[model samples]
Target chain A: NAGVTQTPKFRVLKTGQSMTLLCAQDMNHEYMYWYRQDPGMGLRLIHYSVGEGTTAKGEVPDGYNVSRLKKQNFLLGLESAAPSQTSVYFCASSYLTPSGGRQVEQFFGPGTRLTVL
Target chain B: GIQVEQSPPDLILQEGANSTLRCNFSDSVNNLQWFHQNPWGQLINLFYIPSGTKQNGRLSATTVATERYSLLYISSSQTTDSGVYFCAVGDYNQGGKLIFGQGTELSVKP
Candidate 1:
């Protein structure tokens, strides 16, 4: 399995520009998430989906929107880029362990580095 | 909302040295995890220890759920171990959402 994969490994945008990040997972996970990592800090969730066609806001959901139109794909959109939005973005997927451990161990993608100037 | 704090916040170690990183949460959590973020910015799961103890090779972790704390032990550390370690905790009640600590930056020198 390819696990989780993120498109546009790196991107640069001018303030007010817009873009979308695509995340795909082959593990058939029921949950997917978008998170951002800033310098000197840990990752923070921007949005998440409990299942296909369902999306919810997370800790840092402002300035971003998300959609899960398909079971294998989740998309994050930036309506208008801002310098404060420049950070390393990561996508993760997880599912309830079949072993009944109830563990939600997340798998992450390679990450996309975005720079908003 | 739950809060997580990790310490000592930063550490420098000589290769082959042993160190312990700590995580303290403000509330009880059913899910706790330890992650290592490499210098290249990849987050790798070290342990899914919400309670008791679990060990993988030179890395081990223990979470005392009753005390609302967890500890990560890295024995005989290597240069490859240089990076940030993060502790995340959450409960099923919160949609499996994780609250992360500030992270402990570890630098292992050869």
Candidate 2:
């Protein structure tokens, strides 16, 4: 099963250009997240969705937007990209077991590398 | 807000040696995980130890929830074990969002 798959494995964009990265999960998870990783830094959350049609801002959500139009798809949009926005992006999906404890073991995508010049 | 921190920003080990990586977090958390990002850049989940101890093969993890720290023990290290290890945490208030530590870059030499 393709747990999680991200579109456009690699891309290069000039400053101010816009693009969208697509993430799809076949695990039927109820939650999806978007994170960016810079050199020597941890992955920081940009946005996430608890379920279809619901989205929330994350630790680093200033320059990005997200939409979850379908349960299986989450999209990250860079309206006006900047050099600082160039980073490796990851998408993950998981579920909080109904039983208890709220344990989460996320499944991650391969990642999308974007270079802005 | 919660914050996660990992120690020994980098580590180098000879084949067959053993090592331990630590992760400390501020504030309480409902979920905690250890992930290994291979040289190929794929993030692989290693452990989901929010609390207690779990062992698998040459790897074992222990989480002392009360102390807000976790430890990942790698025994008999091999060259193939070289990678960046990350610790991520999640709280109930964040709607399933996770905070990740800077990571510990490990290099195993033969």
Candidate 3:
């Protein structure tokens, strides 16, 4: 089964251009997250959704927006992309169970590499 | 906000050697996980140890929740094990959002 998949594995955008990255998960998880990975910065959260129709701001949400219109799909939008926004983006999902002790392990998609010129 | 820090920033090991990586976080956490980002850039989940200890094959991890630190032990390292390891914490107050550490880049030479 395809656990998590991201669309547009690679993209090149000119400054001020708009684009969207799509993430789809078949795990039927309730939590989905969007993160950007920069050299030496690890992975910083961009935005996240607890479930369909719910979204929240993350550590780095200034230049990005997100929508969880469907339960299995999470979308990240860059309205006016800049060179500084260029980074590898990742989408992850996890199943939150009622049990307390076990940590919810997140399943990540391959990643989307964006280059802004 | 809770902050996460990973030690050694970078490490180099010869094949079949052993190494350890450390992660420290400020404040309490509900959950924590370890991920290995391969050279191809795929983030693979390695462990989900919020506390206590766990082992799998040549890898093992220990989390001292009370001390706010975690350690990952890699035994018999191979060239294929070269990658960046990241520690992420999940806070209940943050709706289970994960805060990631800077990561420790590992290079295993043949």
Candidate 4:
């Protein structure tokens, strides 16, 4: 099974342009996250979803928006791309058990490289 | 927000040598994981050691929850191991919202 997959492996956009990154997981995980990796910096959470139809902002969510309308899909939208937004994006998913037990391991997607010019 | 820190921000090792990476957190956590970002920018899960020790082939990890620190050990390093290693922590009540360390950049030579 494809654990986690992200669309648009690479993209380049002019300033003020808009784009959406899609993430899908086949693991039936209840949690999904969007993160961006910058040079010499750790991956920072952009947005996350605890379950279907629920979304929350994370560490860096200023210029981004997220939607988790379906259990298996999470979408990240950049309404106005900026040069500062150029970075590799990663999507991850994890399962949460009924008794409050949660999966510690987060399976990550291959990543999408976005370049804002 | 919990703070995560990693030591030896940069490391260089010869093939066959061994090395250790350390991660310290500021608060209690229910889950801790290590990830390796290859040169191609793919993050591969390495370990999920909230406490105790777990070994997987040449890689092993140990976490001491009481001290809020975790360690990753790589035995017989390979050139393929050259990349950035990150330590992420999931807080006690945060539902999988992981906070990450800056990461230790490792370079293994042939």
Q: DockQ (Cα-based) per candidate? A: 0.64, 0.77, 0.68, 0.76
- What local lDDT score does residue A97 receive in model 3, on the 0 to 100 scale? 78
Instruction: Please say which candidate is ahead in TM-score: 2 or 3.
Output: 2
Please say which candidate is ahead in DockQ: 2 or 3: 2
Looking at model 1, give its docking quality level.
medium
Clashing pairs in 4: none
Best by DockQ: 2
Q: Write the per-residue lDDT of candidate 1 for residues A3-63, one digit (tens) a residue.
A: 9999999999999999999999999998888999999998899999988999999999999
Give the Cα lDDT of each candidate.
Answer: 0.93, 0.93, 0.92, 0.93
lDDT of 4 by residue, A1-117 (tens): 988999999999999999999999998999999999898999999999888999998999999999999999999999999999999999999987667566557889999999999
Candidate 3: tens digits of C-alpha lDDT, residues A1-117: 899999999999999999999999998988899999987778989999988999999989998999999999999999999999999999999876767433277889999999999
**Once model 3 is optimally superposed onto the true structure by TM-score, how far is the C-alpha of residue B28 displaced, in angstroms?**
0.5
TM-score of every prediction relative to native = 0.97, 0.97, 0.96, 0.97
Candidate 3, Cα interface RMSD: 1.9
Superior by DockQ: candidate 3 or candidate 4: 4
Model 4 Cα lDDT, one tens digit per residue, B72-97: 99999999999999999995367688
- State candidate 1's DockQ: 0.64
Give the Å error, residue B59, model 3.
0.2
Better of 1 and 3 by DockQ: 3
Q: In model 3, where do residues sit more than 4 Å from their true spots?
A: A98-103
